[model samples]
Target: MKIFRRLLSYLEPYRIFLIVSLGAATISTLVALGPPYLVKLLIDQVLIQKNLPLLNYIILGLIALYLLHSGLTTLRIIYVNKVQQGLIFDLRNEVHHHLQRLSLSYFEKRQSGRITSRVINDVETLQAIVSSGAVIFTIALVTLLGSLIILMRLNLKLTLLAMIPMPAITFLVVMFSKKAHRRYRQMRRRLADINAILQENILGIQVTKSFRREKLREEKFIHKGEGYYQANMSVIRIWSVFFPLIMFASALGTVIVLYYGGREVIAGNLSIGGLVAFVSYLGLFYAPINQLNEVNNIFQHGRAAGERIFEVVDTIPEKEKKKAIIPPSFLKGKVEFDKVSFTYEKGKKQKEVLHQVSFTANPGDLIAFVGASGSGKSTIVSLLPRFYEINSGSIRIDGYNVKDFKLGYLRENIGMVLQEPFLFDGTVIQNILFGRPGASKEEVVKAAKIANAHNFIRQLPEDYETEVGERGVKLSVGEKQRITIARVMLKNPPILILDEATSSVDSEAEILIQEALEYLMKGKTSFVIAHRLSTIRNATRILVVLEGKIVEEGTHQELLEKESVYSHFYQMQFKENGKIIAI
Candidate 1:
């Protein structure tokens, strides 16, 4: 009920449409009542009295009543659908916008597919409830009340007998609603699971095919599909029983009305015409009850979907301090980490990934971090941009704590070129412009030339206008990496972080990229995380990270002379590369 109310509150902005829909529904229901009452007039007053002129009038009136009812019903449906569609649009926009505001950790906790399902599938599931189903439900209640009043006025005794099944029907509805809501919730969850698996497999199809595990993936999909089927079947099985029980309850009312009304008529206590109209009105009353049963199904299904949708909508977004201020437009690029610590929460336990890590990069300093994978090298640089908040101590840029700066302003001054470049599905120019949307064509070309990407881009069919495909799949690995570098170059921020940016390319590409990096790092405080120690040999400062701590820090030659962790790693890499020059 709480979820349902929340769903209704979304309709507040569209209330004018909903009110118009309800108004049309009300008039339609009243017009509908006229026909059955007219049937009574035709039978008792006109047909029996042999008044042909009045019979013609009654017939024409009935036709007019139906036409008006039909027109009003059409108007109601249009407005109802208008309300439903409008609500979906607003809800989806809010949910997607909220998702964008969420921190990276929120995405890390859930699959991309599950999150997508909430935005697309789950939000779509509310369509039926807010459309005709909602209007019908209201009309049913109104019709039930109106029919009851008329029934009592016509024959109090038969109306009471006809309603004997009401309490039992009410009980059935209560029981079905409780069970159906739970079943639908379970069904919705299973459906989301299937979507998750499908999305994962589709994205990893290349991996599956390369491993020759297509059959294995197929079997997994089939297993999830079976779960969805079973869940749907569970709902179907209950529905099959519920619909018949409702019908049987309604049928019992008709039987009660017939047997007792027949006795009343035979006893000359009731008119034949009145009994017929009583039965007709009785059908009208039960029709809406039965209709309510169907509407209940829609409401239950919507409730399940609404819960999932709101679950994402209700999640607390990334926090910014109320007093956060924009940093100066011209940043000095002095980054300092003072005993920063960070713990990652995985289920019940917490793993401290960075332990009192401290470092300082003055303006124009080329700082390098060399460490084993998962040694917190990337996490150290990520903290500079405030991607993840620190558990202790402070990160200050120039003299202001990172938290003191407005998040967007602080990040705008920092740029990153990651190992795996991600490009949106668009042209090369568009991807390059993503770094700084307002950059001009000449500026873009200059950045590309500096990154050594312009030569190959010109050799392509459309130069900068060529489509990159998803994640720049149309381009070579080197091409994509260079484009990302160009993007960062275009950003031309005061601070730059390169995370294994050259590890995946060939030697020729690596040389071009290194040359580009040298130019990009000029006049900026740079942080580089690299497995190849040769790349960082000229760095102004080198830090060796181990087990989430900065174990050793010095120049490349100074670290080698120390003959400690940095020296060990450098020597090992030298052996692998078969190079031992003068140290």
Candidate 2:
């Protein structure tokens, strides 16, 4: 349940690597203890005996010990690196899966830059704490404990004197670590905020240039940059105080040992070789102490990332209950919204966006929702795919409540195209084929031809292999929209949603896409949200929504006959052309 244990789960597959690495580190730490002891033995036994013949053998033995220690250390570091690489892959994969399943509303509220930071920057920081710092701290700690035992055994009085300042340093480290942790957590959050700003600015660079707000944006960026800079400096200040204090305490301990042990050696109470070994181990003691000072700082940032990652994964996913009251083996594209009332929490007054809205679309029906901005046309279409849950009512498909079907199964049967057609950075053919993974090249080409995109695609230098560039920026808006349409056509779902599909394209392109839509809408239940009434003039049914309620509904001719809300929309455009064409 804790962030640490949850994060550790990502490393589960590398259990063997962790165990082996820790073992090697332990053996390496113990083996490292051998050399200084060997030096003591050489001084006390071999050199002290005036035996020059054994000097060559002692040197050879020392070389072998160093080689063994090197090999053990290499093995330990290799496995730690292996675990780190694997864990990053796993954590990224988990984040990716959670992102995929999260409702569209979640993405609507979160920044892409912040999400990117979690996937990239946070993952790297987490791997550092889990792999490098964790392993090193563990080994350093064991070495410190093991060395203290040996030192105390050799000479308790000198060992006690050497360790006298350790407890005070330990208390200080704990206190400073807590403070450092708070500062580092703040630093990571500030970094995320800055990344969010940078990401947004880059995406809207065109708008910024158009509005001549370059200087204004730069000032905003500078402000965020300053915040991050200050947060980082806060961390630096803590480290500045921490590292120096830890070093002074360590130096004080060594000074005490030297002062007391020198007197003992002069009084014949300590051996020269033993005194030399004591001095050698002093530096090793400080190594672990430094890591101890910084471990909390490492953990705090890692936990912050873990918390962010968990916030996404642990969300209460869209409600799909078991033991369905109405279950259908297959969807029939018969959708009905009964007494549906919905409101977004953040909207003004928690105002209902859809008030007791109800509609029924028979199979092969072309149902279009027309309304002004903030009139909930898009929101109604979005609900069909369960992008957002309806506040009060049931949405049923083919006499079965939509909630009865498996989420994936329900989505797989519905096709949707948004106002802004998004394409991944891939070939034209690849982007078109994305709607139907595992689709053959023939199917992909066929779909492109239907959407009127195949001709332009073949004219490109690489044709099907030509990169779309980021979000298909290399292609014109009409080209991207056509490619998206082809993708949806390739999918061939029973139900379709077109949310201002041609609104982003030019007039000529809209006419071309409308032809494609005419064919795509045949033999399927469809919902269209359009600001341009001509786009949906041929729709079988048009519903005029105003203030969360269906103010008018009928065929284009029927609504125009009544001269209500729908008539107002239809006549405005007709009046612009100085002629009224009856729908």
Candidate 3:
């Protein structure tokens, strides 16, 4: 109920439309009751009494009543649809906005499919509750109460007898409701699992095809599909048993009315027309009960979906402190990390990934980090942008702590070119412009030239407008890297972090990308995490990271003179290839 109420609060903006829709629904339901009364009037006054003069008027009245009902029903649908669509638009935007504010650690612990399901599929399920379910339930309640009053006025004794089976029906409905709620929740979870599996398979299709694991992937998807099938079947099983019992209960009420009312008519205590009207009204009463049962089914399904959606909406978003400062412009690229420590918490265990690490870089300095895998090289740079908050010490940019600056301003001034560059499904021009949306076309072209991407882009069929498929899959790795570098160059941030930016490209592509990086790093304070000894040979200071601590720091040649961890890594790379690595 709390979840449902929170969902309803989203409708506050469209309250006027909601009120109009409910009013239309109520009037339509009331008009619907007129038919039962009209039938009684026809039997008693026109047909049985043989009053030919009034027949035409009664028939015209009936037609007008139906027309009014149809008009109100149409209006009800339009207004309800407006309210439903408006609420969904607001809720989806809010959920997406919250997702953008979440830290990277949140994504690391969950599957992409599950998050996508909450954003898309689960929100879609809410249409039933918001659009039709609540309004229909209201209409059904009004119809049921109106029918009951009309039934009693026709014959109190018959009405009393007709309601005898209702208590048992109510008990049965309660049992079904409980079972349906649990089953629907289970079904939603299974659906999320299926979505997760499908998403994973689609994203990793290249790996699957490379390893020739098509059959294995198919089998895994089928396994997930089978679980979804069983969950749906469980709900179907409940409906199969519960609906028939409800129908039987409704039938028993009609039978009671017939048997008792037939005897009364023969006894001359009840008029024949009255008995007929009573039977029609009895059907009307049970109709709402059935509708209510169906509404309950819709409500249960929505409740399950709501739980999943609110789980995300209610999560604590990444904090943006109210008092945080926004830098007037980009910093001068001076970065200092003072005795910083960080621990990653996985479940109940805490593993410290970075020890007391410290480093500093002046403006126009190229600082390179060389370390084995999992030695906290990437973690150190990630902290510079405050992607993850440091545990112990202050990371200062210029003179202010990184935490003191507004998150957006801090990140906007730091450009990053990751090892795996991600591009949206768009044209080359669109991807480059993503760095700075306000950049002019001439600026984009100039940035591409600086990254050595302008020639290849011009060679493409559409020039700059050529589409880069999902994650830039249509382009080669080198092409994707150069475009990303172009994107950063356009942003022109004062501080740059390159995470093995050219590690995955071929030899020829690497040379082109290296040249591009040299241009990008010309005047910025740059942090380079590299495995290739040749790439960082000219770095102003080389920081040899070993076991989450900087064991050595100096210019490349100065570190080599000490024969420390830096020299050992340099020897491993160049001596293995039988080449004297230039420094």
For each of the candidates, the C-alpha root-mean-square deviation to the true structure, in angstroms, is 2.2, 2.8, 2.3
Work out the TM-score per prediction.
Answer: 0.96, 0.93, 0.95
Kindly provide the TM-score of model 2 when superposed on the true structure, using C-alpha atoms: 0.93
Q: Give the Cα lDDT of each candidate.
A: 0.87, 0.81, 0.88
- Angstrom error of the Cα, residue 317, model 2: value is 3.9
RMSD of candidate 1 to the truth, in angstroms, is 2.2
Q: Which candidate, 1 or 2, has the higher TM-score?
A: 1
After superposition, the stretches of candidate 3 with alpha carbons farther than 4 Å from their true spots are 471-473, 578-583
Worst 10 residues of 1 by lDDT: 574-583
Best by lDDT: 3
* Model 2 regions lying over 4 Å from their true place: 46-49, 320-330, 346-349, 471-473, 532-535, 578-583
Which pairs clash inside model 2? none
Worst 10 residues of 2 by lDDT: 574-583
TM-score between model 3 and native: 0.95
Predict model 2's lDDT versus the native. 0.81
Residue 559 CA displacement from its true place in model 3, Å? 1.8
Position 217, candidate 1: lDDT: 93
Please write out the lDDT profile of model 2 over residues 483-502, one tens digit for every residue. 88899999898899998888
1-583: candidate 1 lDDT, tens digit per residue: 8887888788898989999999999889978887888888888888787778988899899999999999998999889889988988998998999999888999998888888888988888977788857888889988888898889999999999998998889888888898898889988888888889999999999999999999999999899889889999999988899888988998999999999999999999988889999999999899999899989989999989988888888888877888986567689999999999987673456788999988899999999887778888898888888888788989989989999988888888998989887778998899899989999999999999999999999987888998896744377788898999999999999999999888788889888998898889999999998655566787999888888999989997888787687677567666578332222
TM-score of predicted structure 1: 0.96
